[model samples]
Target: MKKLLLSILSIISLNVFAQPDVKFNITSDWGTGYCANINITPDQGYDDWEMVIKAPGGINSLWGANSVPIGGGEYKITPSPWKIPIATPFEIGFCGGGSSSDIEIISQSFTPTVTEVISEEIWIGENSSAYLNTGKEYYMVGINKDEPEASLHVGTNTSATSTSIVIETEGSDNAEINFQSGTGVSELNFQNGDLSDISSLTFSKNDNGATMSFYDKINSEEVIKVVDGSLYSREVVVQTDAFPDYVFSSDYNLASLSEVEASIDSLGHLPGVPAAEQVEEEGMSLSQITTIQMEKIEELTLYLIQQQKEIEALKKELNNLKK
Candidate 1:
């Protein structure tokens, strides 16, 4: 696309250079017709400048000049009779019927030499810029660029080390790009200032119902993700109030195996653990679950120690009876 636009500008410039006296600039062009400014630079000290215009539909209206039908889809154009000699090189504004593509300057009579004009197209070259306006909003094509793709297209291949584009907003205001749809809208925002005086980046998906995931490039699998407002990761670490090591204390209450069995029978779950229905309804916290599991393991260890002591005491009593 860059090459194509450059080629087009080159063609327009070459055509203008073909006739050196006239510099044509298209002012505005609608589909059916166009208006233009034709800059005529005549030879030095010659103010009586006239040119022959050849168009498919012919010239309908002309200003800053006089026109006479010279036949063969052409108009013999000269300065208006009352229009005094203002400058050596002057400009003429004209409106013609049909597309600007069919208009051209066949000859001129500043000194019997001819010149040419332009078609309704963007003119981009060295030191030249063009803009297009569909309605009230204006769209510019080039800014310090030989050829540009369109509005908002920035940067080029160069050796200079500098940022291509920079955008700044007022203090305490967020600069955001809004993504809108029929159902809802999402925004990627750069929150700049607040009471905390810190900057942050935020992405809100609204109710788009799409999850964001991060993948491991080497493993080619998702390692972290967000789904339905929750975060998931392959590994996690949680901080809790305390661990189950306190169960080993001498004053700790240890339940007997029969007591634990009775509680399970009556409660339909472990004594200190949440029931399945409860966990399903109001999800489980990782820190709470970890502490509970460790506590159950410690209780089981205590039960094993008590049973070993009973077995030892019974063995001594049986030995005494044998004696």
Candidate 2:
């Protein structure tokens, strides 16, 4: 809820002829309607004082003054003789049909006299509305709330369809919503874009030792988490560039059994394979390791085929020699 206070001040000097000191103060405004006070104080006193106001939405009721619609959103006001004396400063109050922003003082008639001055002040009393000021620096938007703990407090109890806050963006463009800490150094971002690859919603947190965790319905444990730039989950699936079926192509260079044995003896590992110590130090990716393993299996199959052909040739030569 928002409150708008409109105060129009006018000052007059008692020693010389000057403009009439008239002030308009909007004391209470509750969005759809408002109540205001018009205080008139001239340098001198007059028996009869009449003022006219222009209120586009019309005045519903008034006190301390007599009011009549002159024409075209303008009203003439005069001091109610029954309420106060004529020689002193007087105040007029009115309740208007619309917002306080619409009320304006159009004209007034008065004569000057030497009289006591009235100090200017505003009185904001209790009102039956959601907009309330509990204390200094405290504005509350709720029903039957006397005290608010925060600077701007909002409370509501309503149907299931009620929404507290909503922010949206329109048009084809990238959008981002950010939440930052009090230090202003750490932040979390929710982002979206127009392209297919970028159109998906992304959540990111930038900070030291930052961790984002998800929980089950019971919240007894963390089901998934991202900590220190790594992800931990019960299960994960990875997509790679392609499978290792290209190892079976005729253009692939397949090492013979002797060459593979020699390379393994010298390097203490299989040919084209990472060392055990290196893998332990810098880990390995599932996609890369899976492709490498599949390529080795395909090479083993080619070696078996070549060995079978040579075995068949030797068996034939032995049979011919026996004959």
Compared with the true structure, all predictions reach lDDT values of: 0.67, 0.67
- TM-scores of the models, in the order given: 0.37, 0.34
Q: Give candidates' CA RMSD values in order.
A: 18.4, 18.1
Mark the regions of model 2 whose C-alpha exceeds 4 Å error after superposition.
Answer: 1-211, 214-231, 234-239, 304-323
Global fold similarity of model 2 (TM-score): 0.34
The pairs that clash in candidate 2 are: 44-112, 44-113, 45-113
List runs of model 1 lying over 4 Å from the truth. Answer: 1-211, 215-222, 226-232
Tell me the deviation in Å of residue 269 in model 1: 1.4
For residue 225, model 2's alpha carbon misses the true position, in angstroms, by: 2.6
Candidate 1, 1-323: lDDT as tens digits: 11124547566554433422678877988968888888876443232557888866766678888888888888888878665432366789888788988888898755221111132333454535353332325433455553445555565567677777766678998877555555433422222224232222223353656666555544456666677878889799889989999999999988887888999999999999999999999999999999999999998888888889999999999999999
